[model samples]
Target: MSAPSESSSAPRAVNPVLAAVAWLWVLVPFGYGLYQLLIKIPALFGG
Candidate 1:
């Protein structure tokens, strides 16, 4: 048995799958934008 204050103060657990999905949600767009920039770099130099 635990105290009410201790339980309330404990940090909530996060699901790994949800965490990964959240990370990918942010990274995927960022990665795509970076790829687009890289693709355009050669164009900028007329390559």
Candidate 2:
């Protein structure tokens, strides 16, 4: 384990599928909330 740092200084690549899933996990609820807020904006001001 200690010898790993001595091998190279290259950055690790992220898994594309994992990155997509992670982004979806964060964006889904955020998108839903934004959609709901937009739907409610007209009623909030008596449109």
Model 2 Cα lDDT, one tens digit per residue, 1-47: 46767448667777799999999999999999999889989987898
Structure candidate 1, residue pairs in collision: none
In order, what lDDT does every prediction score? Answer: 0.88, 0.88
Candidate 2 accuracy as TM-score: 0.62
Candidate RMSDs in order: 5.4, 4.0
Clashes of each: 0, 0
Any idea how many clashes model 1 has? 0
- Backbone clashes in model 2, listed as residue pairs: none
